[model samples]
Target: MTFEFLLAFAMLVVASFGHLGMWIALYNRINATGLKRTTIKRIEKAIVLACGIIPLLLLLIELNQHGLVGVLAGLFGGASAWSWLTIAYSVLAGLLGIVLAPFWIMDRPHFAIARDRYQVTSAEDLNPLKETVKNRRLYLRGRSFRKMSKLPGNQIVSLQRNCKRLKFKNLPNDIEGLRIAHLSDIHLTGQLSNAFYRLATDWIAEQRPDMIILSGDILDNEQSLHQIQPVFDGLNAPLGMYFVLGNHDRRLTDPTMVCRKLCELGWVDLGKEQAMRQHQQTTLRLIGNEQPWFQRNPSPYKFEPGRTSPGNEWTIGVSHSPDQFAWGIENRCQLMLCGHTHGGQIRLPIVGPIVAPSWYGTRYASGVFEKNETLMHVSRGLSGVHPFRWGCLPEVSVLELALL
Candidate 1:
């Protein structure tokens, strides 16, 4: 037989065995997981479907290149080097894409159903659990996890705060009815519609916030900026709509463009900057730092290239994650807002999230934690990549801080 025939035969043999090996690996993976039989079956089917499509499409392409009558000739006939390589790479990449694509693209909306399972007994159940009077400032998180269909929502956590002296001199004494709607962890991909933004804008407007603080993860892509702007345009804030960037936003091709687009629509980009005296009778210093992704450090102020004291201002330092305790402590921020972990989108019973990207595990995965009298409220965030909600449901925080 010709060398070309031998090569084609070898390619076919290797590919066939490789495909079988991959299928066995997939089967083993499904069986190894603690998921139910139905889930395992579904996964198995998905793997088979992916495998089937690749070989079928390649066969069709081969047929097109060489008519049925010339199938054998075409297999052995010399093709251009580039064309041959392209076809070979396409097959390899297509196989890889089929295998990994499920992790990246699976849109199981189980979290929504999971939210229905949770019953809130009281307002306290919805709020973070606090043991001391000092911990009255509750922290609420938005849905930030990309959930699988069967996961539970976020686990409610609580912490105690000790305040020897209450410090916000400029803060309004009548801050009882004062409301600030905190929205964070909006990973707005291009799929995000103008309507979602409208819903969010309207929700905040209905809350009648004296101020709105958007923590971070503004956009999944720079293109998403255009889609989200019209919603922000309608965001009617008497004080101002403030914003900070998250790690995801920093991954965009041009994060500055995303920032500029939001700012153009009346939101202030607070990264490494401050907005003073925006509120009545109060010097509300809004401080925002860049995403930890850029600095290669999760701690906000630890590796910050620029150093400046937030200075005895009644400041609310906005960050994407609670990685920076030093910045919050040194600044003496009365309140800090953050969102990144979607509360591990899929949460097990008491074991919590299967995987939470934060350093503190599931402890600080969601809700309020007080560090050195600084009350930090981490919003779970608005939307995530995966559609599941598990233990944590989607949230919109209406924070009312009654100063001690």
Candidate 2:
């Protein structure tokens, strides 16, 4: 290509990335909001359309105006070659992140699968292929959108029941082997047959967990709130069933009604209340943070970052979003449990989970990450606002906390 052509193309590429990247950053924040579902969805569509057409228009404008050199000069503003080095560096880093990601299974912390992997099907135990065909006809208009979008896949219907043994420095030796069933993002939208969720809880009951933590996003539409009781029939934890509200939960007509229904079912409302438990003579403090949507109430355990509680207290934070992880670490919360991203609900090959509703993008989409004596587990979650999942599957895990 001629030098001028190359410069024009490079300028177009940079401009496209700039616009797309800015929209993506905006989307990540917008998705984290608890705005009206219809309002946010409209914005999402507009942003997606802009991400596609804006670049083509930029190329046309550059060519039509023949102002490539002038624009390029103003774009860089005579910056040093050092500035362009970032483009090369980010390209290399992104490539490595994709290709080397599969091997992350090796880098992952030591955790046993423990036991059980149930192939959860519909209440009738229908074939998965048959279910897919039924889904196509279910909610014709909206269903057609998600199905034709080819965004995520049937993995949403493919429920995975896993029993994992997670090790942590904060897990007291006495409390080691404590089994906690972590459930998140069962977006009861009435789209998926209730049977799918019931089967998931059946597996949980078999695990016989000491505690059950419902991380968040339990309801997308308030109409589905009624299913909570029937679906969670067999689930019970001696330490108790605790939950925090997620952003989607706030979108409901009455978020408090959701909390009230769960409390009626004997679950603890950790979203607004504090609870402490005693196990094997050790103190376990449970803290709930539902920021960016629901506000956090005053509690001794809630402190500013860099401030900490006594080391002996095992503070486990239950949040809907993983963003509060840094807050958990700062307050000496040894373990933080979250589920909001739904494991990106659509992870691309190599690139991993590209879309997550968080200020941190997809950094902590799901899985266990540890830092400075604190550990956090982000659940892949069992469902989503849209019943689509590509490479990722819905998860219901029994986390056996073990001492490091």
Question: Please, what are the lDDT tens digits per residue for candidate 1 over residues 66-151?
Answer: 65645556557555122364367456655654664353223222321223212222132222223443322222222332122213
Best by TM-score: 2
Worst 10 residues of 2 by lDDT: 112-121
Model 2 TM-score on a 0 to 1 scale: 0.76
Question: Tens digit of lDDT per residue, candidate 2, span 1-404?
Answer: 45655654565465445555567766877887767668888999998997777555654554455455654553454322223333453354445445444544442222211112122222222224345666544423245333643443456566677776677654567788888888999888876666777767887788789999998888877788888888887678889889988887877888988898899888998878889998877888898888877766636475556655554567788888888888888667777889998888787777577667887777778887777776788889987767567777778888877755
- Native-to-model Cα distance after best TM-score fit, residue 392 in candidate 2, in Å: 1.3
RMSD of each: 16.3, 7.7
Model 1's alpha-carbon lDDT is: 0.57
lDDT of each: 0.57, 0.71
TM-score to native of every candidate shown: 0.55, 0.76
Worst 10 residues of 1 by lDDT: 157-166
Q: What does candidate 1 score on TM?
A: 0.55
